[model samples]
Target: MFSSLFKRDDTFYTLLEASAAEARNCAILLKDVMTHMGADTSSQLDAIHQSRRKHKRLTQEVTERLCKTFITPLDREDIEHLSSALHKIPKTVEKIAERLALCPVQYANDIVSRQINLLDLGTVEVVNMVGALRKKAGMEHIQDMQDRLQHIEGDGDKMLMDLLRQLYNGKADPIEVLILKDLYELLERAIDRCRDAGNVVFQVVLKYS
Candidate 1:
């Protein structure tokens, strides 16, 4: 499974790793914006957007490789599906960062921080799962990481509920409520992107294992 996937170096694996790294970077940038909401984060937000664009290019390369190359490290449809899934993690994170940039600093709190932290963990797991294709990792290894990603996503969901509980407590400003709710949902969706990508990696491994 491992040797056939990439021989530790190839265009598909290389591009997948690059896209996964960008996804991880976008997750971290989103965390930074939440941690420093009071400060100017125009540069950091711009970087998040760039990561999304970079992933788009990588995905396009995967499609081009599919057309030009005689064979792929994995099935063509699997490569396309995984590439598309990997790109969504950073793409969704970009949206979350945009929402946070406009949100008031007074609303930022431990819950949002913990949620973003989980999001970071999720993307990191995604990077690990993708890299496993080139690392000769056992099926158990990737599956374990996939399980962890799912756990992180579940934690994010719990935090979302807790945030809703706070927002609906009736003492908060209506406008603040709407903004934070939007931000919370976006963060959860970002976490979902990671879990979804990890699932794709897991399925691919299962096919070749």
Candidate 2:
């Protein structure tokens, strides 16, 4: 019975790892989209769309497997909630990518790049937290990560508001202002989703620990 339980635990961890990989890929795709601001966005959007689809499929598989298995590594509800939150990461990224494709703007300003970098860092930290989920007692690091994510997200919000105000007040072309507004909003949304991911991880750690 002990051996059987260990096998079940390994299977659950494997599923969680797969989900984390998908989330990481989504983050990378978002970074690529920001890096190639003026380049052809068609390919980047396609890549993000594909990643989102794959994440959805993997999430479904994990859920179905959890339902069928007699033993689970964590509480059944925790498994369900974790899987749902993991699925949202990619979906949220895809939404931003789609909006970006619609509003094509070449950002000469560095604010976009900085915001994307912060978002990527937050995603990386959250991914690390997800990996440590199996060890409930090792979740002390999650609180630190959550705090960092919140801080970065707050910074992003402030930067976005400042830039928006400058754009509205400055002598930039109206069309340019519109494009930057949309882009800034999308970038802020991405950062917000990363915070949401952190919150979900925090809940998981709290419930289990």
Candidate 3:
């Protein structure tokens, strides 16, 4: 009876993991979209659309579970915040794909590639952080993952700055400049969304530690 009183459900953790997985899926699709710079992006956009739908479903599951569960492992507010952050990632990635599809740019550099790599890496860390909630999570371990997310976000900022500098160097076509600028900003925002999710996990660990 005593053990039952302290028993915690793993459903919340599973839902969070599913949401993180969707974010990773979105990143993968975004990376694929970047690889085929001038090719048709319809398939990639469809994949991201599917990923966004999956994420939305998982988030809704979490919300509905929250309403039913009397005792959650984590605070209600933290769960909602993290769910919202995870959803934003794929949503932003979908927007990026849509923009690229509307106005395809032929770039000759690896700036976008580097950003996609960082965004994917950051999403991976977010996944790890979310999974940590299932185990006897160590504050130090969670901090390490959070640190990785922060590093990715910082690198994204530096990369965007350098890319923008090149864009304004009066060499590339003005139309290309406009398209790349929009895509770069969206990618950076996606990375920020990853960071936001990581921070929520970190805060939850801190609160429960």
Kindly provide the TM-score of model 2 when superposed on the true structure, using C-alpha atoms: 0.83
What lDDT tens digits, residue by residue, belong to model 2 across residues 1-209? 55654455557766776787788788889878876666788888889888888888888888887757777877777778778777777877787676656655554467767877877776787677777776664566878877888998999999999989889896988888987788788778877877876787788788777
lDDT of each: 0.86, 0.77, 0.86
| Candidate 3 lDDT for residue 136 | 56
- Backbone collision tally, model 1: 0
In model 1, the runs with Cα more than 4 Å from the true position are 1-9
How close is every model to the real structure, measured as TM-score? 0.91, 0.83, 0.91
What digit string (tens of lDDT, one per residue) describes model 3 on residues 60-130?
99999887776778888988898998889889988977876776555525777788889899989988998
lDDT of 1 at 69: 68
Candidate 3: residue 193 lDDT (0-100): 94
Give the C-alpha lDDT of model 3.
Answer: 0.86
Each model's RMSD to truth, in Å?
Answer: 3.9, 3.1, 2.8
